[model samples]
Target: MDTPQPKQLSPRRRRALIFASLAVAVIVGTSLYYLHPIGILAPKATAQAASTTLFSKPDTLVSYNFESAQLGWALAVTETRLNQGPFWIFRTVDGAKHWQRQLVGQTSSLFLTLASFQFLDPTHGFVAVGNPISLYRTTDGGMHWLALGLPYADGYAVTFTDPLHGWFLAWPHLWSTSDGGNTWNQLPDPPVDSTPLFLEFDKWNNLVFRSRLEGWLGSNGAGQPHVYSSADGGHSWQRREVPLPSGAVASGTLRTGVQALPGAGVIASVNPSTSPNALFTSFDGGTSWSEVTPLPIGGGTGDLGFQDNLHWWEIYVGALYMSSDGGQTWNHISDELPSAVSSLHILDSQHAWAQMFFAEGSVLAFTADGGLHWTRANAPQPT
Candidate 1:
């Protein structure tokens, strides 16, 4: 038989067909972005990567670190429940106007698993993920990451002073890396007494390194607050006896957190679950701590953020306080915070970011002009 010409649709029919095809494409693209399948979908952290397209905004923030008022990163999960699965590392270069997904973690366990991250600067960063944790290092500001071996399956925190010098803490054991994070060396067992009675090092305690050779580890929760100084790059540690305020007896479980200050000192806040909290300072790099001021407010537990020894801030029980003279005195800034604040970062006396948690969801708050005023930054919004 001879070849026959095919029939063509009319103008109206053609328009309908085109619209139908476009609708289908839109639906498929949205489904893929929203119902992101675990392990199958991973975002490329490139300069040209589209922001807020490949993944969902964080349901809750796990941890966050800001190198400056404009540059920062947050470790958050899409699920409301923390242990459900799928964690993401988001970087905001324009002061939280937009956040780019730098990393994704596939971790869904029956038990709760936590993720911790640290950025030595705006460029070099490290993240510890999964229940039996996996460590990754990014030298180019999360544009790329290389997996690093961990000495232990479970680790609570990671701190890097420089690209070459870093430390990882897995409760009683600590590990160090001198050549970036390519290899790890198990350091001398942490001082027996430095370990907290109930290990929540990832939450209340912190591991901070001031330089390649000097670092401090704060052990708190369910015991007398303890601070240990590691002078030889975490190879050895010594307990820095943190004395209580004069005639201030400990009543409840005291929690302590130490922040390596800007120039030459360390700042610590010893907050108790009960009343009568205290703040301490160390001009000698945590070797000796003297009570700076008896905290005027007391509560369940709070967080401390420092721009330097001279400028510090604290968020406790949904209220904000600032100290102009290095934690000696405080002025209540605002009580309008929704709830608990985590990832409290102070870039300067004026610029800062904090993730505030409430009953419905979490919001990222930014402050300018020394926290006298605050505004909600453009965090990821659920589609």
Candidate 2:
């Protein structure tokens, strides 16, 4: 591979914005700005690595999903400067000690995960790549990919209920993929505002659907953000009212992020434009909500992994915190990870994987013994 040289002002400017904050003002989910390349500056230093550094260079890792400590998958986006380049699909069978890179597709977003990507398992995955947008699928793990049968992507977000059922979101445009991601049939778009904008990180990265019959989508363009509820998948949606925080108004710059657990209630967090934010949990879908606890503004809201009302991990600026007994109690983990924590997928009370984000590179961290210890994982190789 050739050394990455700074590309154009367009890609660099966009990339810088994506790494700065997960701030999206768009109502519909499509308000995203893709950033690729190092631009004229080098990588920023924020988080720290283990005594045993995961990678010698600056390649980064993203812990998307995991089956076990021995088998997992992540995204490996290399730091580049010249033109948009191919990113990697990272897979590990024996934890993070060793890693293999499978080149996927050329990207315009340094933060490609925002460009819409997902893997149902080690065998089936989808990635939207290049401009005018295209979707690619990998069935035999990350070994190879085949172009998906779709119309146009222009950057899309995809989610899978299983290896066979899935949904694709590109804001006003939505599609359903029954046989994994091989092919998609366009569906009726969600009822959103006429104006179309991009979101850096509004609430959830994409639409959160607990089941085919139940899901939640966000709209935040006119003034404040609103959560849309769907009883019959994306076929139709209606506004789900939420209890606002002390300083939040029904409409303004207020935004809420929602996550639904398998056996637990739907939990959502609200960040107001002016006042302190609060976390809320709804046992009956999103129709009615109650406040759980007040939240401390952290390093970043990149990764707010909530296992239940009590068990979850969140970051602030750079500090990491964990809660075991829902939100009634809390513990400060550390503030020197490297960058803001983006994604934290906790397997049990003890083991989990996390990804940190910066401008030029991304990083990975994992803990086998709960919050007692953490190990910096691996980065991609300079190909």
Candidate 3:
């Protein structure tokens, strides 16, 4: 038995032996199959079955039949060579897939700046008209517009909690409308040395106001921005200095939009600037502030709106960015749009519309799926 022991192969020889064994086994198996057929050969089919599921086209616009829905309405403006004219009101009861243009009286200058449009319900709404100092209301879902003559001088922004209660602000002045925008009475002006600039109303009816009232008002002034709050419906305002990010100076330009969160006294704003624009959040009811984050794509104007306190969306450079983490982070979702977005309006968390301003063209793109996709609604042909 001791003399019959066989020699063991080395590691390298072992590997070679395993490889040779595998090769021999494969060759033998192949030879056996070819030399003697064991199973019948089936004819090959030329065609394969098509996949049953339908896929959405990546570039196709999501359709919404706005003509059947009561909330469906269009916001359009006629832009001239020199200026953009009054905003045209269009309504579609179905969903926004189709729109019927309404005839609002013509204006002298197409320079009619419409800052904002909002509806408390299907039948009642408010529109902020720029330069001429006018706010229009339509109780019949924009079938006809009635001019609410408020003292207007370059009005920048307007918001309404309901048909009877609303707020509008021009620089240095805050006005409240109790009679459905028919008459807007001015609230107390900022201190003689203070100059108030932007205005917003929160869900709790607290008014959030901003300006350089604490410092200087213009370029020569202190160049700092201030935030003020009024709990008693703009009867009196309390001022607080809003802190800016390190190395960032307060931009004197009026902010584009302000949105108020429901439970958290948080307010958000789109800080306008040529450099990287900022989205700011204020937790203490606009008294103190902090920059949420720099927008993903910089350069174009930015606007902010909230579907709720936790969900936020912003539009800049014709793209939509959504943040579910209260602006801590953002996700870019603007592939469907064709042009840069100049303004955005959110009806709720699911439904929204954006106004696209083409650089050299007169066309506008509208989005319904939180800007996931967009469709070209209307455009003026080139002259």
Clashes of each: 1, 26, 18
Candidate 2, residues 216-327, lDDT tens digits: the string is 7654443545577777767888776667776666656555666676565677666676666676677776767676643455422335666555688765554567877655
> Candidate 3: where are CA atoms >4 Å away?
1-70, 75-87, 108-113, 127-135, 151-159, 168-174, 182-184, 191-224, 249-277, 295-305, 315-320, 332-334, 360-372, 378-383
* TM-score between candidate 2 and the true structure: 0.74
Give the per-residue lDDT of model 3 (tens digit) for 1-383. 01221233343543332222111110000100011111112132121111111111211111111222234654444433233333444555444334455433322222122234555677876664433545667676655566667665554346666678777655458677777877778877644333323122111112332221211111112435444455667667655454444456655553322344644645434343534434456666565677776665663325566667768777754467888887777898764543332344566665765543322322334555566765545321111
- Sorted on lDDT, best first, the list reads 1, 2, 3
> What is the lDDT of every predicted structure here?
0.60, 0.56, 0.45
The reply for model 1, stretches above 4 Å from the true place, is 1-59, 78-84, 108-115, 197-204, 219-226, 246-257, 269-275, 285-288, 294-302, 316-320, 332-343, 381-383
* TM-score-superior candidate, 1 or 3: 1
Among all candidates shown, the one with the greatest lDDT: 1
Pick out the ten consecutive residues of candidate 1 with the lowest summed lDDT: 22-31
